[model samples]
Target: MIQVHAWADLDYDVLVRDMRAVAFDLDNTLASSKQPMSAAMTDRFAELTHRTTVAVITGGRYELVVSQVLDAIGGRADRSRMHLMPTGGSRYYRWHVDDDGCGRWKCVYAHDLSETDRRAAAASVETRARELGLWETRVWGERIEDRGSQLTFSALGQQAPETAKRSWDPDDKKKRMLVAAVSRDLPHLKVRSGGYTSIDISLPGMDKSFAVHELARVLGVEVGGIVFVGDRMNPGGNDYPAAEAGAYAVRVGSPDDTLRFLERLLVRL
Candidate 1:
């Protein structure tokens, strides 16, 4: 018999009564950059949803983010209670499409920085950077992800190699260094690291944390009614949004760790 960790065998009557919903940050929370959640996680999530709503919020693009849902939670009927908020809290969609195939989808804020501006900004930033010799551009498909906002710098014109782009700073440490360096140069913009390899800049107050708060209004639950789990909870990271919303923040170890975390949460609730 598989020896389930003590985490798998917990009592949940305490921490759950007030929890109207449970939100998770994708990537490291639900699935690691390398693997998806194990069966243990999906089953645990299924178990948890029997008591409270579950939502997933991530900085990953929408198309890619939903696939994670399909993987860990394919056919659970309570899926209607599951929510998927993607793009750094820039988008929201509830689980379960209605008869016509639509439940709830909201795109709060987005921007398109095309190649001209990308070139202009990159030229400005890179040229100044050259003068300072502080930074270099890792061109990815004419799309200058000035952080993660997806600037159409090259009009999505010529593409850059995904392998090369991802390798630019796989751990995101280099990207963090780049954010600090560029923000020092462009102080007016809010520059921060997101996902695994991207740096994003936005106007102040343009972030997912606030987005979660905004999205909470739709759930009709106080921000405090939600418990958010995520791996990245640093000051300017993507997961910071959920942590900031007055929600209970549960930090876990890996992509699959969330499953066990949920199981513990369910039993303890």
Candidate 2:
């Protein structure tokens, strides 16, 4: 079993103060899966940007992050200090403020797959899931989304309710099976389980590990100088890559835990 630690288990003051950046996994870490971030969480996140550089790295698309996170925090944050790494870090966006102080997001880099690759990936995921008897007849929204830098396969559909998604595959068995099959078919691509009942396929080097290292390079901090917080940090979980890349890892069970973590971090920062 993965060892679990409480907030008090670490020397949080020293850890928080020494860190140059704090990176987070969005879905379950910041909000309920595919749900909007709560007002309380938004306030704490906005407050965090002022004290330290913040990076949101997730398997979600940029637009999803915008609606669920950025828009919710709207105008209350130091956008310049915030970095958005989405599509499992295959793409990156940073804030740009215009003369009138109207801030907008600007893409820094995107490792989008070619049209041919995208088609192949989508085909492989669908074919394998069906072969494995994992495809759902009823879904909430688009099951396959062509995110620029990655392709996501939401088993229950993108708009599935949180309760249903949570109950679908609590231990990630189904997703892991799907990931393994898709990975074999698309050997050159990176395939991993994402969110509650989803799979993410991207370029080999594009993942949360890439996000961590890239952020460290851009922010001029050593790998150890960044901390990564997430809900899923187990071996094959999407958030595992950040921990593998050497970011100090903090795990939270829900957004409430994330809020409490932010509260403690703000006190130290």
Candidate 3:
């Protein structure tokens, strides 16, 4: 079963006591989807970095993380203490200091799908969408994106306004139908709903839990020593696997709620 916490009712001391690192989901947890991080969030995140290592695990591509998240944070946090796991942790990136002492991101490992697998997955998504009548629905931008290790199908288009995206699938009925169709058509790929707008399809064994284990090994820290904060920790949610991986998990409602939780956590730290 998943453990849920209301931001206002959380016990700060208990949650932060043994947490040596904190992991976050990027889109709605850290910032609005496809939007820049806020000034308050940037300052709070920089402060948190001083107390513990930080990692961002998201279904977004590496380029989006750079342009939307890192840029929004203004590069204030120490690169050495930060980790980025994009494509639902199928790709892991870390910072390395070059000869000039400037930091640069390097991919430590990536579970990229083979060319054949990518083509098959893409075809399955397209076919499934049409069969489900999803193609007839109104969309805002690109509906499908191939993020190296993962293929995502956003119902309202990736650039759809937040209001439209949220209203489009408040109950996730449309996306759920799409997921079932895609899963049936492509059993070899892992299909899961990501955030409010998209479904992510990745290779077998490439999920947030895989990323957590890899993060633990690379950082020389036990999985139990980490805390994962995300909005989607329910049974079918993408963040569910991280909780099952044995990290202490906290579920928040929105980016603002996450900020509040982080502020409380900082006080305890």
Candidate 4:
């Protein structure tokens, strides 16, 4: 088993120098929950891409990645050096740079769930959450979403503010109950905790583990040469799968911590 290291404890110079790629979790790692990258983060991330291959693997859809990350960095960054694996690596997008310097994203692969699987996951998620009294009475936006390759259940609704999301189930108790119940009903599907208060349902083996290998394969690097950084590396956290996949995983406290690490890595690279 791989040991998760605290951001402060890592040898940034050695790690950054040897790593072929750096992958990040979107929410709480690269940006605030459901929010765009901050100005500092955008600049640093754009710069980092120019130095080494980068990727953002999230439970969010392609649209969210574009809105929350790519849009913020714009053409300033080297998109060709980056990969976007949305929906927990169920879908992968690569960038194609044009002769005029404009870049376009291409969907190289997608593992979208079938309609039957989507229906089953959505039903199981809602039914189990309600049965366990974990479903909220009121929500900010959507409680359940069909994200093409994944079905997500957000406890406090998809549009819940960052503050509310942070406070909803800090202990992960509520999400644990919901995830367990849903998983039992959908034995063939993969269900894991996502973002701040969301549960992601995807095809079996289609988690961050899949993302790690996919990134390495696409980048033509060994799995050990990739460094995945995220806020969640605990057993049930979505980021755990990356560690399980044999990548050097470092756990950070928040996006600020992630930014600081990126700065150190940039200096080393």
Candidate 5:
């Protein structure tokens, strides 16, 4: 079992005084479902950028995460203040602005999935899920999302209603149960939560925490010098990895909770 911690309850001031970078998760961490950031939230983030570097490490796809979301948050003073790590710690892409008022996406890293191996893995995962009574899988771009490394089994597939999905297993009861069953057999593979309704199984020893530490390395800072903000850090939760590694973590409810946390962070800066 992963030991859980309430990172917000730590001596947060010590981190603010020493840290040089702030990384966030996208979706519920920074963006709202149907509303853009309020003026106050954007202002607070801009000020935060001046005090420390900023990035958004998410689980969305690169093109969509960047073009649809990161691009919208671009008017900030420093464009380099942001980044997008999506595809379940599989990739990192930096955001840059062009002279013609356009944006550019430069790929920093991505795990190469060999087609031959990936195909074989996908089939194995799908057949297992089906035999276990799970439904069909959802695709993350060209790849099947078996959790992170392989196919996804949403209680209600990708086309399921949003209201239904958010309410289907709000506490993630199903995903956790799925992980337990899968782990019992595939002990060599890693299984964790994906988004809200699926299990992400990476090669043994990979998770969102791996991505957060990598971000710290790229910025030439210690894990102690970074802060990770996300809503779910419990075991099997996506943000659990960041919380486990000792990053100052802020758990938010609504996106407003995230920005409110940022408000306090700005005050410290």
Candidate 6:
């Protein structure tokens, strides 16, 4: 079983010495949800990449990662060491050097939903939302988004301001209820709570654990050799599967806490 530890409880030196790769949850862990990466974080991440492998797995779409994450890092880090698994690990993008020697991200693999499954899942979410009185709630932007491999329902809308999203479901009561309803209505699809305002529905077995195994294969490391850092590693959170898959898990509270953990990890690495 994977153990969850606070950043303070970890022996920084021993932890870094044993790890082969470090994986992170992008949204609230690497950067605030829907926001650009901070300068300090970008620099620290670049430095971290120099020492070992780094990967980011998120429930957001790949386009969102390019705009909010990669663009902010500005290409100084080694792309060979970076792995991007978007759509809650249902899709993976890897850096590739073309024949012309230019580097770019290529889709290594994607567990895309069939049209039939997508339609049914979408309909189920809508029907359940209406049943739960969520359909009448005011939203800030697109509430339902199709991320190829995952269908997302953002209660406050995907583009809602961070403050609004946070205020909408600080305790996750609304989202937990919605998750339960959606799971019951769409038993075939995997439904899990993401960030503060979103629920991710993907094909069965396509959660972060899938991404963890894929990363282990790519990096040539055992599952136990990897470390995962995220804001939501508790039961029912999206990051929980990585822990279930046997990766050493560090559960932080926010982006600032993530940064602090990274800072300490870098010192040891």
Q: Best candidate, lDDT-wise?
A: 4
Model 5 lDDT at residue 95: 65
Candidate 6 per-residue C-alpha lDDT over 63-171 given as tens digits, one digit per residue, 9 for 90 to 100: 9889877998878888889999999899999889999999889998899998888888888888888887777467878988989999998877888877887787777
Candidate 2 pairs with clashing backbones: none
What is the C-alpha local distance difference test score of each model?
Answer: 0.58, 0.88, 0.85, 0.90, 0.64, 0.87
Q: Considering lDDT, which of the candidate structures 1 and 6 is the better prediction for this target?
A: 6
> What TM-score fits each model?
0.68, 0.95, 0.95, 0.96, 0.77, 0.95
Q: Write the per-residue lDDT of candidate 2 for residues 33-125, one digit (tens) a residue.
A: 767899899989999999989999999999889888987998899989999999988888999878997778999899999899999999998
How does residue 149 of candidate 2 score in lDDT?
89
Q: What lDDT does model 4 reach?
A: 0.90
After superposition, the stretches of candidate 5 with alpha carbons farther than 4 Å from their true spots are 1-12, 33-43, 96-103, 136-153, 159-162, 180-189
- Pairs clashing in candidate 6? none
| Model 1 stretches with alpha carbons more than 4 Å out | 1-13, 96-173, 184-189, 202-204
Tens-place lDDT digits, model 3, residues 1-269: 55656667877788777778999988889989888778888889888887789999998999988986778676678778899999999998988989998878999888888888778878888888787777746787888888888988887788888888778777878788888888887788888888787899899888888888888888898987778889888877888888889877788888999999998898888
In model 5, what lDDT does residue 166 have? 69
lDDT of 4 by residue, 1-269 (tens): 58887888899878977799999999889998778999999999999989989999998888989999999999899888899999999999998877997768999899989999999998998899889887888789989999989999998898899889888888899888888888899999998888778899999999999999988987788988989999989888889999999999999989999989988788887
Clashes of each: 24, 0, 0, 0, 8, 0
Off by over 4 Å in 6: none
157-269: candidate 1 lDDT, tens digit per residue: 22334345445555656655666776676565556676554555555554567656865787887887777777766555567766666766666655556666665566566
Model 3 CA deviation exceeding 4 Å by range: none
**What is the Cα-based lDDT of residue 203 in candidate 1?**
51
**Runs off by more than 4 Å, candidate 2:** 1-8, 99-102
